[model samples]
Target: MTADTNTDLDTAQLPPPAEKSARALARARKRRSVARFWREYRTHRSGLWGLAGLILIALIAICAPLLVGADSQSVTDAPGGALEAPSGEFPLGTDQFGRSVLALLVWGARVSLTVGLLAAFLCVAIGTVVGIVAGHFRGWYSTVLMRVTDWFLVMPTLVLAIALATVMSRSIWTVILAIGVTTWPTTARLVRAQTLAVESRPYIERARALGGGHRHIMLRHVLPNVMPLVLAQTTLVISGAILTEATLAFLGLGDPTITSWGGMLQDAREAGAVSAGDWWYLAPPGLAIALVALAFTLCGRAIEAVLNPKLGVAR
Candidate 1:
């Protein structure tokens, strides 16, 4: 009886197997969530291709001079090389001035991508602040803020951008600023609507009942919930900004000193590539711009699918 009692006491002193099992289960659940996210991302064909294309473009942009072995703007008066089609020496061909078209494209991508990312950041930042303020605080403040947004919404953004660019120096920064400032109204409205919906949730009401400060509720509770929507909108805005910059550049509003995809198109037009049947000059840059825009659109759609799984199968 003494021996049996001692053995029972030792067994009782051991940690609970159930607790160990629960901990292991929790770890498994965490791993499963991570795996699920990756699986969803992998399943998204458009998103995968888009990401691949963007990365390739970025790589080319980063290694432009090294890969192409020429300055984007350096004009070569190689009479024999003018309007040469794609070949071993110039993969994409030579422009009217015998400048390597491949080099121009690589360098131009750098400008387009930079403008897109910077403009999108500025737009998203301004929009988020305006949205949180207007949505979290109702009454006169909301009305005033929304009215201002509405005024921007009604304005002709391209005309306003052209006017601003005309008034300011025709530079990349000016273009970025004009596009970013004009584009924020849409983002602000979307974020505000999201914020209003999040604020009405039961947890938000509880936070209010618990005397949580406005800033606390806005930042901690509201922002995180609405971040997915903001990110999706940002992708679309980035694509729009790129297209806008290209349009501005194509219209001769672009800084002449800067090499851009649109600038290349302008040069092609000036060189009479279309009339002269020099298809090589116009095709490459046009295709690049289209491809980049398509990539962004696809990625954005994929993200939306992942965020809102109820809309369709998980991306």
Candidate 2:
């Protein structure tokens, strides 16, 4: 009996299975989720294509400096003159300033992508906070918050963005801020709806019963469950943000220092590239914008279908 008790005590003293830290466990789960998502995404042809296109765009953006050469910034205009035709020397032709269309297109990718990603991140962060708080706390506060969200939702997004941009300086960051601030309502609404469903689940009730605080339960329990939806929405938001930035830039609201696809289009329009049938100047930037939007849309749809199985139909 003495030996058995000592053995039992030793067993009890042994550290409990060297269990992983919560952070480590969370990381492992995230890795597993990513793997699962990739496996599922593989079957989606459009999604695969979209992913490939985005990769290609990113690669182009990264390689712009190398491809554009050392004099890219200074050599905005070609010696060949404006509205030049496509040839080996001036592939994609030249703009009104005789700027290499290919160079402008590559540099434009950097601006559009940076704006889209940063603005989407800002909007998603704001929306997630508003959504989680409103959804978790039901009552007068929730009603008020939802009402505020509704007010924003009912407003014309582009109009509000344009107003904001007009009020602020004409810069890339200003445009990003305008779009981010104006676009959060839709994301907030989506997150709130998902949060409500998550809050009503049995596990959430148990977490509450176990003396979990509001912050603890909401962050530790609720947020993870709603993240897939948030991620899917984020992709959609990026596409919208890109389009919004383009619209703003096209309307002469863009930073004069930067050259974006929309700015290219605006310049082309002003130069009568369309009327003159300068397809090279007009098509490359337009195609870049469309391709980016289409890629994000495809990815968002695929993620939505996979995460929200109810929406997964034969497509």
Candidate 3:
């Protein structure tokens, strides 16, 4: 190549001297942190297994329409007799309404998982906001917020949820709302502790000296630091939320029009499945609930271990 052509190529390859913006640096750091977290999380075998199970269950719920037709819920057009035991025609048998037990299980997963995830996220969102505000702001505001959280903390969560569900409409949304409101106290407390610790750091004073407002301080500094604790708490909250949904459904508080794990148990009880020794009708839903709860619990524990290696050592 000519000297002029080689000089032009070298000049074109030169990088600009300008540094990355503060926002860009923050985003890069966040991406790196998330990548590190995932790498650490994969080291936990139990966490990987639990994550796989959750993905499988979620996929099944999302693909329910393709796997089983919507007609599976039709009582009049049921493919088998009412309360039929497992046979060549019906693998999991039939419920009291003559619907295929296998179809009911699949459909129930959608509702149960929906309620669990929505309720858990709603609770965590509220909890994170409350905890951050309470921790960052002192005096009466913090006192009032903490007092409210404490009241919810001291009271029976299930009782509050039951009362809310009973007074409100009987629907999936209502169930989600009830569980979310009642189960947020623990999360709030945990996040508040983390927030307090973060606020005590030296950089917090530096941010304030540079004229950071409350919004800027909390969003830029406090929230990111406390997010790990919040994330860990969410998976644990999901398990409790699922259990609460099941309890509410079992108590006949869930919308009767839909099929859910707890609703199936309630139906089997009402239909004398237990009286007639129909194990197929009762066992599947019960086992499904137990398995889902266990999966979430394992995931939460694994996440905790990833965040705090000391906990893993303690275990």
Candidate 4:
């Protein structure tokens, strides 16, 4: 009785330690993982150089007018009229219509970069959703989705892109759409593989057992886990997208009004720059396109190395 008189410790009233909710804990883990991944990614020397180059190109694109003092859009105001050789006044020379080659190159940077980024974004957005749904649902859902993806996959991306670009208007946005649509099959395939791996993890099973709906689990758990792969794939895709845009422009499938690197090349071709010995015009845009693509490629390879260490034989 005396012992009973000692009030039982009110365990219920004792506050539980401030444990994070499952979502919060997951978010914290993701943050840590991302930090680790970034740390690993930065160690890649080629990646660092690629990052620097990309930043430089982006800056050049952003400050086009200030750096060149030439209007890319103007056809008549070129400092030196008609294919002037590179010199103090008009470096990078002039195009057929008296447009400053320097300015055209600068402005073209904006177009090419814009198309690459936007198209990659579109691919990632579409690919991620399709991949998650196909990976998680299984059975008929996965079968149908995979089949459709395979259908797109079998077709050559460049050929399909050309066909689509021909059917669509020759505009920057149209080019973006064409490339995005053609390129997503690869992204979808990659994302789906990653999603499948993620979905198989024990935490996903636990999430399923905990009464988490498909939407909740997929969005809250699956997508976050697969983002690294998606990101790396997106980087690779950007370089491809830029190349595709340039090719399209070079082939005269691009908007005639927009002054892109490809357009510059196309103009050069039309104006006989290739045959007329205008190496200045011919080389600059071509080199810019190649260098920019190389930068992205190097960065993408670095990211792939970090995410998939097996690929990092040199590292």
Whose TM-score is greatest here? 3
Candidate order by decreasing TM-score: 3, 2, 4, 1
User: Candidate 2 vs candidate 4: which has greater TM-score?
Assistant: 2
lDDT of 3 at 243: 92
lDDT, candidates in the order shown:
0.87, 0.89, 0.92, 0.87
Off by over 4 Å in 4: 1-35, 70-72, 313-315
Estimate TM-scores for all models.
0.85, 0.91, 0.91, 0.88
Judging by lDDT against the true structure, name the best candidate.
3
Could you tell which candidate, 1 or 2, scores higher by TM-score?
Answer: 2
Cα deviation of 135, candidate 2, in Å: 0.6
How far in Å is the alpha carbon of 241 misplaced in model 4? 0.3
TM-score head-to-head 1 vs 4, winner: 4
Decreasing lDDT order of the candidates: 3, 2, 4, 1
Residue-wise lDDT of candidate 3 within 1-315, one digit each (tens)? 899999999977866444336667879998998999999888888888889999999999999988988888888898888899999878899987788999999999999999999999999999999999999999999999999999999999999999999999999999999999999989998888889999999999999999999999999999988987888899999989999999999999999999999999999999999999999999999999998998998899988898878885322
Superposition TM-score, candidate 2 onto the true structure: 0.91
The runs of at least 3 residues in candidate 2 whose Cα sits more than 4 Å from the true structure, single-residue gaps closed, are 1-17, 21-28, 75-77, 313-315
